[model samples]
Target chain A: MLKSAKRFALTAALALAAGPALGGALGLGSEARPEEVTAWDIDVRPDGQGLPEGGGTVEQGEMLFQERCTACHGEFGEGAGRWPVLAGGYDTLDSDNPVKTIGSYWPHLSTVYDYIRRAMPFGDAQSLTADETYALTAYLLYLNEIVAEDFELTKENFTSIELSNESGFIPDDRPDTPGLSEREPCMTDCKPEVVIRMRARVLDVTPDTEDTSAVTSD
Target chain B: MSTSRKPQGGTTRRGFLSAAGGAALAAGAIRPAVSAGPENLPPNVPGWSRYLGSGVDAYPYGQPSSFESHVVRRNVAWLTASVESSVNFTPLHELDGIITPNGLCFERHHAGIAEVDPSDYRLMINGLVDKPMIFTLDDIKRFPRTNKIFFLECAANSGMEWRGAQLNGCQFTHGMVHCVMYTGVPLKLILEEAGLKTNAKWLMVEGADAAGMNRSVPLDKALDDCMVAFKMNGEALRPEQGYPLRLVVPGWEGNMWIKWLRRIEVGDQPWHTREETSKYTDLLENGKSRRFTWAMDCKSVITSPSPQAPLLHKGHNILSGIAWSGRGTVDRVDVTLDGGRNWRPARIDGPSFDKAVHRFYFEFDWQGESLLLQSRAIDSTGYVQPTKDELRAVRGTNSIYHNNGIQTWHVRGNGEVENVEVS
Candidate 1:
């Protein structure tokens, strides 16, 4: 107990003394080493700013996808049980039931590389090597019919591969819809009649419960 | 005040009779005798009143009364494929006021909660900076702090109801939001310490969670009101809320406010991460979609008289709900009892803060008449909340995010309420 108390006291002293150490006016944090920065700076931009050096073939990616990703993503990347369909959303962007996938809707190829490398395979993230990620990207491209099955993906040809919806995204221009103005909203008789157009109970998608008392009690 | 009139259990005569009557009714007794001499009545002291309560130190950290156990966060089983990636909603109908209790705040985790130890927590500032720097949790605390109240809303809060009302309760329809006071240092101050490079126009803020969720935030907003919050509601942030650190992008979509924040990489251009490109982007009727749509539009919902909180009282009840906007404070909330036929301004109460939830109430006398209820929020930016049809007219139902359309609740004569869409 005495030793722990002494350690706590020393920590408290160091915390107090750490206020001024860097070039900033407050100088609170220490200079980060290049290695430390590189370890966490994993984000890749559209211009291919942070693509890792690696290469892999679509054939190799098919094997990896079946082994590591098939459980949730399915063998063809169609997605299993709401786990994001990653292929064959080509012409569905304009349909009522749009199927947004990496091939159909994603604008940049770097996103696929970055996402797979940083967070993929669901529970076991950051487990893919750069080569494996490249292979998976190639396989996903094949699934979406964007590339031939024998295509090889590498850092050299990364930016050359563009998506179907590369130019599909526009900046936010809200207040574009009508009826959103500075004018005061009507207080009385805004509409002639109010009729129920839809009811949630009809579809009844809410999770069922044997007892609602616990859920409804106020 | 007379001892002779006082019955056995420290109860006044009238009080004892009323207590007995209430208990009997609750027990579903066929008929309650007013003078039945219940053992724990006013005449006979109540058991809890007579017995000693638990000692002061019984609960080191206090909790709500056991009776309130039912009020909790709930998840829809079909919402996601796995529990770790799923989202749960706050019990909005059962709560009043703007502040959501830390425990009751809605949680949206991409890869479950990251249990980060504060000692091992490090926030690195890299990329376009004069000198990249790493700050420990203690080093972060050494900086000057600021406290502010803000609402963090999921971009997909009302995304389910875009096509139509699918959720039966407000908890599911509009529960993906919460307001809390955060204590932290401004992002500008932290960036200042790092000495951002001249070309730095955007930041790729990443989380340490297993999902490694990341988003690119514009530098202007980072220098504006954004904060790196370590404490929420005056206490150390709950583990589910990013424990040692989280970014507080006031008024922006909750996804931009990265939790379990670990690094901020400055860059000259947007990274267009998976979250920004595929997930949070709003699709339109045309094949084109809207990217980088960060602001949450004006929206409001009626809490009471909703599906979970049915009306139990007939005369003189208060109608309560919450309103907020990503652009600014809610200027006013209009409540329409008979749908769009007529409307009235609900009373806006409590302290109003920028990007924070606003509490509004409307008092009325009900006489068992069926009614259609709806609320419209107008924000300081003069943006009036649009109806479901009005919103669907512009952005197609395919857009899975940012559904700020007005919500409608139907109340039957039996005091039961249901989710509905009106025309």
Candidate 2:
């Protein structure tokens, strides 16, 4: 009888919380334990909100990167094949072949630590300790000439070290373009001359159709 | 499987043509107007009519006709380092109407497909919530459900064509987008169940994939239209499309729709994750970049009469294409046949849903002259799809994503089509 009374009270609370407009909650799902939230809260913000207590040096990062990342990111973070280049490319953002690297393009240092901590080491992810991630981030900074070889990175100084392109990003201000007119779009004689500026046949970069496996073979 | 014997000396029209020789086929000679004109005519019954068909359960789950086996997703190998972390293009030229079939939706995986078992799936809501909650797949289903049709488009759909017309087919140039009807519960109900705190302004939704793909979304948008979808087109979601459950951020770039959804953390500030920073962010030519450019601009493409689907006849051709907008429904689509010399409104023939794909077509009589075909889309916002040159003038050629420029297809007199750029 006492348990039945408690259930009735819980249902009443749920209905009041949901409000009449929403028709009340169905009273599903269990309250999550503190341990469950701790296990999944891995994100780190620009203001160093979720960082753990850890520190590592650039020397340690170099060794760790060589052992775990060089196969894909290259020995000096120059990148292998189409893999991401983690270092250098400080001022190439405006050039034709803009090589955006950690030092050049990334705005906040927290992203480097978060990415390495969440998903890194290529095939293997979430396998690194906080110390290892900090070390790898410091090593990348040193490789990009942002830090000295002996510089160490810690949670306390994580926000102090800013990336070069921190001021590069702006909010989306689209429809900022010109040429779109309020008048009806041109239908007849929009351009005086029609010239073929480029053709895909000339470049011929499309994959060969013959190489594609036939679906019927399955 | 061998239900009948082969007909003696079965000389069908196609068989007769093939038996003639290579020269007859190469020169485009002796090609009948209709392939089934000979034995399959009304006077003589076709071979299939005489034979017994396959019994029930031949395929427990049905498949497309074998004749349409060529319709399949394709990928450009050199675009990425490995197949595990790459993308594939949908066979857009072969598809019609607005709904993309389940299997043909283009896939872009950061670290391959994660095969998650339904029994093991769990979605947790925590951080800044009055009461943190953990729910199994069954628990999520108990909430009120809604059905919405929305198009999920990768921001890099036309990214490769930023500089010029490089890819030969529409499949490569504009196949990174797909439309589907999703059935799921409104994310607001789930968040309300967890009871949001006053400080909750942003949400960090993370997936359970090996890449652990995550993105920060403003709480306003989450409450407006976001969904926790577990089914697509009235069926359970495909494994590649985040089986069990996935977040649906309608009208936004596809990356923000985190698949294999696992957790949602309410926060006060954006996380600035790798996807938002190191990638997805548009790099302008002036060294400044555009971050959080979420909504896909109004875009359209001529699916047929493209490089892959060339013109086969000289008269009465139906030019078909697709148009969509991330902000709202497509309002109008215009077609140009003479390199912008003349334009006419194409007939939109399907149901118009907000932030969903719209199908359009223009029927014309072709007289075998060379033609330059282009289609322009205008959305509810009156935003006209810009020309490649016009877009280049503003954003420059460096911003690889969101190249919603009008595409040009050159149709030769020989009934062959080629991807081209016009000035």
lDDT of 1 by residue, A56-126 (tens): 99999999999999899888999999899989877888898899999889999899988988888787898
Q: Give the per-residue lDDT of model 1 (tens digit) for B167-279.
A: 99999999999999999997877887888777789999999999999999999899768999999999999988998899999999999989989999988899999999989
- Which residue ranges in model 2 land beyond 4 Å of their true spot? A1-24, A178-181, A210-218, B1-37
On a 0 to 100 scale, what is the lDDT of residue A139 in model 2?
A: 95
Q: lDDT for model 1, please.
A: 0.85
RMSD list, candidates in order: 8.4, 6.8
Off by over 4 Å in 1: A1-23, A178-182, A208-218, B1-44
Decoy 1 TM-score against native = 0.90
True contacts kept of each: 0.69, 0.61
Model 2 chain B scores worst on lDDT over the 10 consecutive residues at B1-10
